[model samples]
Target chain A: MITKNRKITFILSLISAIIGIMFAIQLKSNMNPVPNESRSIAELRSSLQKELEKHKGLLADISKYNLLFYQYESSLNEGDSVSVMKEELARAKRMAGMVGLEGEGTVVRIQDAVIPEPPPLSDLEEHSYIPNAVIDEDLRWLSNILFANGAKAISINGHRIIATTAIRNVGEDIQIDTKTIRPPYEIKALGDPDVLISGLKLEGAEENLKLAGKQLIIEKHDKLLIPAYTDARVIRFMKPVKTKGES
Target chain B: MANRKFYLYLTLVTISTGFLIAASIESTKARNTERQNEKQFQQETQLNERILAEKKENHQLEVQLLELQRKVSQVEEALAQRQSEAAEILSELEAARMMAGVVPVSGPGVIVTMQDSEQAAASADVTKYIVHEQDVRLMVNELRAAGAEAISINGQRLVSNSEIRCVGPTIIVNGVKSAAPFVITAIGDPATMVGGLHLPGGVMNMLQDYVKIDIQEKEHVEIPAYVGDGKMDSSAS
Candidate 1:
């Protein structure tokens, strides 16, 4: 009888221990569940959607180019290739920023902030003052913001921004395409004025400029003219990549 | 009496064990139903596979489009050879397209690769060490100042209106989002571009502390054409 009792006790203890371990595991897993996989799955779904849209766009581009090629071939057959070529050249020139363009857009003016008069000599030590000045980086950031907001064409002062245009500081002066520009810098961009204005505001352009001791003044214009890139562009390094059939 | 007590203890322990098992089963079932099940895992895998397939197809279509564009160019060249007037116009158009970044270009230039500093992942102040949109813009400006004729970042060709800006942690170039490391290829004098980047207080010097940058001069660098919308509808000249 004693031996039987001992066997039962041992079996019960083992069963109880297993239950305790299982209960601990269940409690632990419930408390600290695995990282949410659903969130990542949602991300994957959105990315997939973006890729599908891009695929559609690429398909559209291919069709458009195919149509253009067909037109060229037809023009060749009709002996009207010159006119068609001229039209194509004109379009290329316009897209190359080789000609002036005018359209409805927005005008942004950046000016140096006016400093108030100093209170007194004794109060100067406690007052930390930042100078009000417009820098090259400010213009670069503003132009980038404008372009991202769908600005088709942009010009600062009178210098038109092109593919190779560089805005940088040459010593103390801000140069746009090798021309020194001064404040208050007047920036004209051709696009939807409301959208451009909202872009600037959304980027907190005013607040940023204010922190730098400059003022941002934006105006919507019904007609804004952006000049052509005047700097002489010499292409020396780049050559067109030859196609497989071309010699 | 002892036997009776033993039976009572055994009954209590068995009941508790049964209760623990039931609770565990209940929690496990709840979790499985709440978060992820086998079906959800399978669905996620399927979605991932679809995305990968779509990306592959898009790449193939882009190549096909490039070929078609080249055919057009070949035809134009053949026509230009037949007529002198057309020849002049064709040459001008070629130059304009090159300047507008509408045509693929190949030449000797420098490629600059930039990435977030490795220490940034461990550092508390991560923003200072990571690459930003301003850093990229500054790099491009420097390259252009050094006379980079053609430039592209991660295959996105730079055009007159190309915008490089930061949206969250990714950099958007020509309306497409990409993350570091950004590889900027410039077709120009490699030595001059390298010098420009290394100038004291230049973009490289300023950003060197925050990011990892490597500049390589290569004899051949091929830049693709701008695939974005080339038409300027707002510009009515």
Candidate 2:
């Protein structure tokens, strides 16, 4: 008994209501953080990124077993094999954090954006050396050093260490991620400093810093706390590398 | 006549029922297929990622192993080169130890300085001009072309994985801001690293034409620690 227009309206309304219900259910699953694709660099910037969360999860899972053995490691069994293994594991984790391999490494600040510096005329003496572009050269060298040192996570300043972190001189200052970090910027490496430092030296990266009157420091810290990753888990979703048949 | 009408009504009902069932079946099948496709894609991607990661780890091990073998072979190479084996081991250790990142070794290298001068407004005395991102890019490309084995800017270490970006009027290196005077360091054989710039239209001459950025060579140089994120994903390898 319904007219054509009335029937169309009813069907449309039904579809809308069903869609609304589906969206409402989805919203309930994830509260607070709106999801977006996570680039590795964003997570690396925060001190408590998702990688840190993962490490904590790992620690929690391992601690369940560790607690049973901790009781066993009392008075008589001070140097038990299990205890020794635990200690070794701790050392490895510390080393990993130092060079940014396993856990997040301590932040070794490199530079900050204070006002600007006035240059002296005497600095431009005849035959004085000068650099051309900064971003490209510096980034290439840093990447070379990191790979050599076995760093798994590195943050220039506040930027998270993602797979896409770039080092380029945009205009006035050297740009890292999207922020401008002036000197002396701290570089937080999540791996062993010794290995990282040595690797940089082998590639001759250290040589350049010295000639330029730059401050270079390598420290071995116990841990680096990173923030939880709040971005989307999947990346580049629309463009499927595989074809429909393959998928 | 009554039987004929009854038959016609039964046929209509049968047709409508068949159409509805067919539509429902098609929709269900499509949903299942979509789900199956998604699952297969994820599995394949994961497998590819695992294989790539293993290869990268294997490559690192291989490079380290090669360096070790080079040191051991130094027993012969040192004698042939007429260098002291003790000194040769020291040099080789210094090089190989770097990849392993065990020690900081000093070496000859190059230093590049950049300054950005804001364009003069109404009342400012100026010496030249501001530094641009392209200037930095040119210098980096020049250094690489000159065969500089390593480089860093504002303590952001350059590796095979490092990236630099240009934002507005500033330069970002490994997510760090390094304004003028921007210093770029390159490590390599001092003679070659420095000499490489002497060629025509290289970084040095270009600097002279541009902001007249400075370039210096040091017999002993020490590059700073890298401060970029080194997150390793399974697919990045």
DockQ-derived CAPRI band for the predicted complex in model 1: acceptable
Residue lDDT tens for model 2, A1-247: 4487456555554555455445444454444343433334332233223224333333442343344344334425323433433433333222222223335334443322232564565865743655432344564456545644566566666444442234555566766545576655566665556677676667665556545544355566766643321222221111111111110
Query: What is the docking quality class of candidate 2?
Result: incorrect
Regions more than 4 Å wrong, model 2? A1-247, B1-105, B117-128, B227-229, B233-237
Q: Write the per-residue lDDT of candidate 2 for residues B95-188, one digit (tens) a residue.
A: 3323222222235678888775334232265434556665665676566555554567665555434445555555566544545577877666
lDDT of 2 at B16: 49
Report the number of the highest-TM-score candidate: 1
TM-score of each: 0.85, 0.31
Q: What is every candidate's C-alpha DockQ against the true complex, given to 2 decimals?
A: 0.46, 0.03
Mind giving the per-residue lDDT tens digits that candidate 1 earns over B88-177? 888888888898877789999999998899989899999989888889999999999999999999878999888998777677887777
Q: Candidate 1: where are CA atoms >4 Å away?
A: A1-19, A22-42, A76-79, A114-126, A244-247, B1-31, B34-50, B230-237
lDDT of each: 0.83, 0.48
TM-scores, chain A, per candidate: 0.78, 0.43
